[model samples]
Target: MSVLSEYYAALERLKANKPIILPKGSAINNDTVAMEAGRKRGSIKKSRHAALIEAIEQAAQATGQNVPSPAQRIEQAKTKTKAVKSDYEQLKEDYEKLLEKVNSLLLENFELKQKRI
Candidate 1:
C-alpha cells in the first residue's frame, strides 16, 4: 500500500473512534496523529490539511462516546490549581505560627540559662 493509502486508513480508523499508534508506539493523540500518519504535526494545526483536520477534530470531539476533550482536561487542571493554592495558604499561616512559637521558646530557654549563671 502507498503512504497515502496508509494515511487515509489511519483517518478512517480515527473516524471509527479507533486508536492510531505513533512510530514510537505511543497511543494516538491530537499531538501524535500526524506523526502516526507520517505527516508533519503542523499540517493539522496550520490548516495544511483542512478536511483531515476537521475530521480528526470531529472524531475526537464526539461526546457520549467516552472520549475526553482537551477543554475538559484544562478545566480540571485549573480547578486543581485553585484547590492547591487554598491549601498552600493555610499551610503557610500554620508555618508562620509555629516559627513564632519556636522563637518564643528559644528566648525563654536563653533567659533560664542566664539566670542559672
Candidate 2:
C-alpha cells in the first residue's frame, strides 16, 4: 500500500498494457498515474518519480510496443476529429452551393416555358 508499491504496480500495468486501478477503483491513466502512485500530479518531475517515468518509457521502447499514454491518445483523437469535422463542413458548403446553382437553373427554365406558353 506504499507509494513505492503503487508506483511499481503502475509500471507493471503500463508494461502489460493493463489499466492501473486507483484506490477508488478508477482506472489509472497518464493523468492519474502520479496521483494513483501517491504523488502529486506534477511530481513526475521530482527525482524519484522522474526516474520511474524514465523506466516506464524505456520498458515500452524496449518492448517495441506503441501503447500510447492516455494523454497522447486523447490528443491524437482530438486532432483526427478536428480534421474530419473540417472536411464535413467543407462538404456541406459545397453541397449548398450546388443546390443553389441547380435552383437557379430550374427557375430560369421555368420562366422560358412560361414565355413559350
Candidate 3:
C-alpha cells in the first residue's frame, strides 16, 4: 500500500478505537499523547471555533444586537470550512489519480515486455 493509504488506514483505525501498535520506544501507549497530538493538529481549534461562534451569538442576544440566526452562523462556518477542506480533498484526489496512472503505466510496460518473445 502507498504511504498515504497506510496513514489513512491508521487514522481510521484510531477513530474506530482500535489499538495502533507502535514500534519499540515509540510513545503510543498513552492515549492522551495521541489525543493531545490531534488537539494540537487543529481538532481543538475547530471545536474552540465553534464554541466561540456560539458564545458570540449568545452575547449578541444579551446585548440586543441584530445577530444572524444560529443556523445562518453554522452555515457560514460550514461555508468557510468547506473551502479549506475542498482544497485538501482536491489534492488527495489528484494524488490518487496520479498513483493510478503510474500503476497503469507499470502494468502496461510489463505486458509489452511479455509480448516481446
Candidate 4:
C-alpha cells in the first residue's frame, strides 16, 4: 500500500482502538498514528502529510480525546464574538431608550415642583 494509504488505515485502526502495530487502546495522536502505520514516531509532519494530519486531528476531536483544530477553534471564536457584539448593540440601544425616559421624567418632576413653588 502507498504510504499515505497506510497512514489512513492506521488512523482508522487507532480510532477504532485496534491498532495493528501499537498496543491496544493506544490514544490517537500523530506519533501513535505514525507508529501504527509502521513508521517512526513523528513521521507525520504537517509539511509532508497535512491532509493526514487533519484527518487524524478530526478523528481525535470526534472521539473527545483532543481539542478541535485551530481552524475550527477560530471559527467558533468568531461566531461567539459576533453573537456578543450583537447582544452588546442591543443592550446599548435599550440603555439609550431608558435614559431618555428617565430624563423626560425628571424634567416633568422639576416643572411640577417649580409650579407648586
Clash counts for all predictions:
0, 0, 0, 0
Candidate 2 regions off by >4 Å? 1-65
Off by over 4 Å in 1: 1-28, 32-46, 49-74
- The residue pairs found clashing in candidate 3 are none
**Global lDDT scores for all candidate models:** 0.65, 0.69, 0.52, 0.91
lDDT of 1: 0.65
Relative to the true structure, candidate 3 reaches a TM of 0.32
- Cα lDDT tens digits, model 4, 1-117, are 899999999999998888778998788889999899999998899999998888888898888886666899899999999999999999999999999999999999999999999
The lDDT of model 3 is: 0.52
Predicted candidate 2 versus true structure: per-residue lDDT over 1-117, tens digit per residue: 877677777667655656544543333334456665556765565565667666756766665746677899999999999999999999999999999999999999999999999
Off by over 4 Å in 4: 68-117
Instruction: Give a tens-digit lDDT track for model 3, residues 2-84.
Output: 43344345444433446246332222212322242332322323343454334434544554555666799899999989998
Per-residue lDDT value at 6 in model 1: 60
Would you estimate the TM-scores of all the predictions?
0.48, 0.46, 0.32, 0.56
